[model samples]
Target: MSRISNGQLVIAFLACRLSSEMITIPGEMVSYGFDRFAVILFAKLIAALLYLPVIFITLKFKGDSVITAAFRRNRAFGITAGIIMSVLLSATAVQTVLSVQRYVTDTLLNNIVTISGIAVITASAVYGAVKGLSAVTRSSVFAAAVFGLLIFLIGVTMWDKVEPDYLYFSFINDRSHFLKTLISEISMNSEILIFAVITDELRSKPYKTVIYYLPILLILMEFLNMLYNLILGPYMTKVEYPLYIIASLSDIVLFQRLDGIDAIVWLMCGIIKAALLIYCIGRIYTVCSNKPHTTLAVAVSGFLIFMLCVILGSDAGVYERMTKIMNSGIHILLGGVVVPLVVLIAGRTKQRGRVKKNDENI
Candidate 1:
């Protein structure tokens, strides 16, 4: 894969985050007032802080990833880094597949988004991974545009149904609930791990991407959270997909309803996210073997994700438990903080040795 523009990265990551948000599985708060509003806000702030090491190490190498840089310094170090990141990315892909499956099975109102959604999506993700990030990035632009339009239409239509009384804060009195939700939000920011791996390899460093992606995501989350609270009020907790429920009411003159549009856009985003994870995994394979058979990586990733979803069936509780175990705060800390710091130290140590050798020879 070739290097891509920062703008592409921004849209791709944004799409992935949007997709993750659209498919909130079990274990996430059902309703419980506006605590999620604060959760989204503070969780992202903390995720950004946690992800600083990764951002720093990636940019530090100029054109190479920290893993690649470290591998050049020591083969073992590089392979270890590759293995660690591969696990994290694989877990993320599996989690995404499970979430999509869960959302479909739980919300059976729409035949457009079918029970076979995971298989179709996995196939598309493999194809996209083979096509590479550039292709996925282009698709995300369209998905984002569709999603933005849907949000606009929903907001306009549901303005009358807004109830400000449901917008009360509750995280203050609920410390344990607040922390659990915060960790989940941070864990859901898998795009951070995606960004760290993909950008620096063959592309420009992601200085502008991070700046644009996070605030946009935070603002969008806040808007959607507020919209959920306003339109559904206390009743949102009863259903699985709040966006789908709200989209059912998006009845304007030109169109009938937008629930189908909503489902398609998020399904598109989920594919984009999965393809990205597969693509990044392939990139890591290149780093490990110095061979670039990304197609093999993509194929293996798609197959595994499909099988996992199939084996797990459509059990929301089981998928949620597995994902929670796989993508906890500890995993985030290891991927975003601990692993990057190790790669950085390896790269810097190698650089210092090179300098020392040059000086001694001189």
Candidate 2:
């Protein structure tokens, strides 16, 4: 496998973090009566704070992949983390696939035309994973370029229409709701797990990557939220894809409409995110089994996730239950908090043992 640059890795990371949520986040924020602009910016601040521990852990490992480093410290702990992360990422993949299907079917095509949207996305993700991280990383760069262009066009075309006064901040009276959204959104922004998973394949420095990439991601997220608030205001809650709706109103000279461009960006980013999730699962499978199972893992994982979407079968209750579980920071607690803490403890224990041995020898 070829080593990928930090820029490409960050692009892939941002693609996974930014795409699907672009549509739902605005609505989610509006429904909870949180200021759309402030909440997104707030979420990034919270995410950066929460991610400090992970950053410290990554620095400790230096050139090692976090997963491999954990295994060297304690195999059992590493395996546990892998299992937890695999499950968490798989659950996320299912939601992503569903979101992509919903958006494409709703905006670009009819039900009959997009009946196989789920299958196509799953297949594409599997193929990307099978091709390996290098391919996916390069593809993310292309996706990011497209995303950048789309963002530029939106900002330029919509500038005259933006309402600066609408960019308001307010403390929601519903404390519980506000806290939940805050925690969930922060956890949602923890796309660092992907970096940890593929640490070995990346050519960039971890500390620098985190420092440079996160602020940009946060700023882009803030801009999008501000755009939504400026154009749609409180009415954004009524729309399914407010950002896409805003894009549709763009009046660039060459492209009179930008919704299709917006959809393509979302679709491509969604697929990249799904592929990265599958790739992460495949990495864990390789670690646990002590063999490369990339092919088998991607196929089986994609199929299982697709089956899950099918089994749930448009049931609102089931979807809500799944969403609640995924969004409740359980993944963050288990994969981000618990597993890393355990690994850190194990590393300390092993280091102490080595130091004791040296003292006794002396």
Candidate 3:
């Protein structure tokens, strides 16, 4: 398989990293009160700014995966970072399985095929991971296009339901709660940095050029959040999946219900997301073992994911608890603190090595 271009990298990052989860943002935002939209947006904007330095550092080690960069730069730090990331990614994959399963059962299959949902999702994810990044990239590119069309169609269909006035005037009533929720959103979205390790596979572009992609993604997410909040109103806070509710309300001449379409699109997006996480785990495992068989690494990682899905399938609550912990706890530690520290330490180490090399040459 050919290496992915920078364009593909962006698509993969956007599609695999971002999803209908943005639909839940409005629901989460409403909990802080409809007044919090501005606060959440501002908070997300700040978080995006903070991500800049990490992105720059990631690009500096573009050719190497994060695991490789860490180990080559600092063995101890790299191993520690790997363990932290592995736990988070594994937990995320399991959660993705549960989310997709529950969504499918509730929205599409009417709970009849609920138990089989996780199995189906796990199989699809494992297939993509085993096929390698090239396959994953191709799938993500296609999925991104389809996802865009779906979002556009939904926006048009729901145009009348949107209360621009409410969204425009909304403000967060509780400053502390708004700040806490904003931090959570940042932690969740910032996992895209995991892809930075493979940035070398992308086409080389100006540093600032990559930064431009951030706003586009953020805008799309913000729009989705706003739409959900407007349609569901305060009731959004009670809805587990606001996007599903929004999709259900969609009606056209031929289709009375669009929830199925949204569910399918989200299911595909979840597959891509899970595959990427599995790929990261595989790469980390390979790097740690110093193994040359990327194929074997992918298989082993895929097996683990499949096993986890099966184990978590019987108790949906367990999956939710695991995700709550990872999303709230591990994501904060890894994305908010551990990763930035690693980048700083790696940057300093690289500089020192360069100076030493220059002195030796002199």
Whole-model lDDT per candidate: 0.78, 0.76, 0.67
Show where candidate 3 strays beyond 4 Å. 20-28, 32-36, 49-53, 59-63, 74-80, 112-115, 205-210, 335-337, 343-347, 350-362
Q: For model 2, what is the alpha-carbon lDDT of residue 91?
A: 79
lDDT of 3 by residue, 252-326 (tens): 766677776777777788888888878778767766666753867777777777787778777768766765565
Which lDDT tens digits does candidate 1 get at residues 201-300? 4355566677777888898888888888888887877666889989987788777888878888878898899999988888888888989756887798
Clashes of each: 1, 0, 7
Error of 3 at 280 (Å): 1.3
lDDT of 1 at 316: 55
Backbone collision tally, model 2: 0
Tell me the spans in candidate 1 whose CA falls farther than 4 Å from its real position. Answer: 25-27, 30-32, 108-116, 169-171, 201-203, 314-317, 355-362
From the highest lDDT down, the ranking of the candidates is 1, 2, 3
How close is every model to the real structure, measured as TM-score? Answer: 0.91, 0.91, 0.84
Which pairs clash in model 1? 3-202
Candidate 2 Cα errors over 4 Å, as ranges: 23-25, 31-34, 113-115, 168-174
Worst-scoring 10-residue span by lDDT in model 1 = 106-115
Residue 16 displacement (Å), model 1: 0.7
* lDDT: the better of candidates 1 and 2: 1
